[model samples]
Target: MVVTRSETQTGAQTGAVQNSSEGWKQQPPYRTTEGDEGFEKKWTAHCHCGRVRYWLSRDGPLASKFCHCVDCQALHGAPFQWAAIFHKEDLRFESGAEGLAFYHAPDKSTTHRLPCKVSCAYCHAPIMDEGRNMVLMFPGIIKFSDAEHKKLFDPQCHIFYSQRVVDIHDGKPKWSKLDGKSELMKEVEREGSNTILGEPKNENMQD
Candidate 1:
């Protein structure tokens, strides 16, 4: 899915809102590298206060990207949001969901939805975004062993680049809106500097 603002604002009610992560017990436990023959690589992530923790089963994320949408900028209080995509089943909570809190966009009362922003209740640190079939995890919270392991979450492209507050010079593709659904914007060369294809070069100049 595209994981747009509208989708996060009003996701279909799947069932009763889960109050705890007790249901996560049904999932298999993470494997260790000690003597287990079937030891699978896993990545552990925690909130600011360490009250909320989770594990990713896969070695790497299914997809990773930098989102420049206004919604993300406002919610994160940053220029962009870097997110790693993973199947809903790939994530598992450590202890329970007691320390986790959810924020439903548009309407906070609607909690029985698929798309919602998960955060640490105490520290108020944004964790991951839960979607219907996938979850957008924040790479910052993950504990990577080294620089190489961290590269697994590197963004492949910039989405919603048209809404970006700052221009990026990276050679990675920049999409006007959605990744594959929108236009692949060309990098315009102005005064020996590259800028967005259709944007005015002058900062204070009106379009």
Candidate 2:
């Protein structure tokens, strides 16, 4: 039930695209908590103002998806949210840890307080969404070329499609909610009465 800081701040546009604290490297390639200080090559994430920097040893996200839920819409200011999930241990902030801010909220259907929204105090850009075991990283933060963006930012499915502010016709599977265990979607969901094939379902930009 957790989401990335950038997603919530922008309006939870699962269709597109946190933290603060300490001990981060002040250099360009930041290092994360243990796991394989053993491994080298990492992916660095930073705030809009270049005030914060973090890195991921994982070459890519463990999972990727587009979210179309009300929470996402209320946060990311976009039609849908594009997210990539990674283990918390894989993310690291090189600097600006002390300048981080957190927005704590109870997750859906749960009463426990969780730091779901994290942002940089200076630039206020989303860093990551922390879950119990993993973090939802935003691909939009990555400074990628058009080719890398296309190849590295592939979403596998759409979650919470029923609350969609707009429709996507990418042919990816759409589920009503967290169907992570049931089955992964193979084709796009085309159930809305007002939906038209091959066109976006009037994307909402207002958060």
Candidate 3:
């Protein structure tokens, strides 16, 4: 369900191209506020089961990064989590808000709390990490028309690299913990390079 710029050019164009002879109906933008005072480009996204749906106010995320923290790996069941940072206000859920589930980290409680992970209740698909100030939305769920549009959500850096189960050589800055607040890790050219140059080996790698 990719939405390209050309497809969203004009309302009349979108309405005309609504359905194909093959019975495939084009998905329109969740909402378009062209005449609004502070209108921004909107992007639509939904859960795997299509139960929960939402849209982003801006065309691009504020910040995007790969998180390699133990919590992220454990929750996502992946090597690392690619997250797109967005202000809470910019994200609007069009449906299934009540059908969404929350998982409070570390404690693993279901209580609605800030800095918690959100997912589709029925499909159990990871949605976003709701923080106090911002939300870290999973870019994988977002619809991109093309590679260029997808690149808008490309990760700027890697966080919690020290705890990563896998080494990423994308050349993005690797932070030992939080970006800016923690040590910036030196890059290793070799594939299995674990030890950081001139730094003590992290023997306490999380399993």
What are the Cα lDDT values of the candidates?
A: 0.70, 0.58, 0.66
lDDT of 2: 0.58
List the candidate 1 regions with Cα displacement exceeding 4 Å: 1-4, 8-41, 110-112, 188-207
**Count of backbone collisions in candidate 3:** 0
How do all models score by TM-score?
0.75, 0.66, 0.73
User: Which residue pairs overlap in candidate 1's backbone?
Assistant: none
| Maximum-TM-score candidate | 1
lDDT by residue for model 3 (93-116), tens: 664245778776534577454446
lDDT by residue for model 2 over 1-207, one digit each (tens)?
432233334333332211233322332123434454665545666789887767776777877988876666666677777888876666676543456665544433211123356667788887766554566788888766567745666898887665565656787767655535323433434774465422323222221
lDDT of 1 by residue, 1-207 (tens): 233556633233444354355453243222223343353449988888988888777999999999887778878989889999887667767654556677776456534234678788899898887766677899999999999999989999988777776777777888777777667776544357654433422231122
Which candidate wins on lDDT?
Answer: 1
Q: What would the TM-score be for candidate 3 when compared with the true structure?
A: 0.73
TM-score-wise, the better of 1 and 3 is 1
What RMSD does each model have against the real structure? 6.2, 9.2, 14.1
Sort the predicted structures by TM-score, highest score first: 1, 3, 2
